[model samples]
Target chain A: MEVSARNALKGNVKALVIGAVNAEVTVEVAPGIEIVAVITKSSAERLGLAEGKEVYAVVKASDVMIATD
Target chain B: MEVSARNALKGNVKALVIGAVNAEVTVEVAPGIEIVAVITKSSAERLGLAEGKEVYAVVKASDVMIATD
Candidate 1:
């Protein structure tokens, strides 16, 4: 599928925590570099996500924030 | 400042494109690895963003998405 989000880091699912409404997914894009994502539980089920599965962590440019040190 | 977002990539602003209500900022986190972010012009101004300024590209876990190939 074509995704508009500019960032798409390929990684393997490291962990998953399912709550009432949201599911937190941790993807390790690189060695010791992980991206954590919180998506809806329904979406998690739809994606059939599980630990060790390969996935991409997507983030839109608009949702990104600029911060200073 | 303490940011709750897990991902805070350090980079320098490579470019800035200001629009009527939004500003697009490009941050080069690593050589040839750039992350583009679109934020409100007001926020950009408040942050004093400019090319060559060091900044962190932040994103909340909730705003992240998981995609498969």
Candidate 2:
């Protein structure tokens, strides 16, 4: 089964990439919404991310695919 | 404008809700990707969340939106 992308919303989680590592990354974002994006450590640093930056916090609806009980 | 839902993936962020507190909520999720979701604090606790629990980490692609400077 497939869920419409609309079903995966976490509300106003917008941000910018302030830091990046291979697995762990940080987004400066706006307001107080600083999200520490956790990914592969190598993927982090390789992204060459840093301070005063801008990057989309890309996520897959399917990867965000959910199941509950 | 619209972004294909495919472009929003954060890879393996899949999880279950183990806790909720209106503004801050915790998801059991799978693996080590426990997302500390920050919403309206009331939305958190109202969810009446707890340990050994299950809940969908609902997020919107539009709300997960991005902009650069």
Q: Give the number of the best model, judged by TM-score.
A: 1
Per-candidate Cα RMSD to the true structure, in Å, reads 1.9, 14.3
Model 2, A3-28: lDDT tens per residue? 33322222232332333442434454
lDDT of 2 at B8: 23
True contacts kept of each: 0.89, 0.22
Q: Identify the runs in model 1 with alpha carbons over 4 angstroms from their true place.
A: none
The per-prediction i-RMS, to one decimal, reads 1.4, 9.6
**What lDDT tens digits, residue by residue, belong to model 2 across residues B1-69?**
333332222323232233344234445434444444545544435555455456655444333433232
Please report, as a value between 0 and 1, the fraction of native contacts recovered by candidate 2.
0.22
Candidate 2: TM-score? Answer: 0.32
* Whole-model Cα lDDT of every candidate shown, in order: 0.91, 0.40
Error of 2 at A33 (Å): 24
Candidate 2 residues lying further than 4 Å off, grouped into runs, are: A1-69, B1-22, B65-69
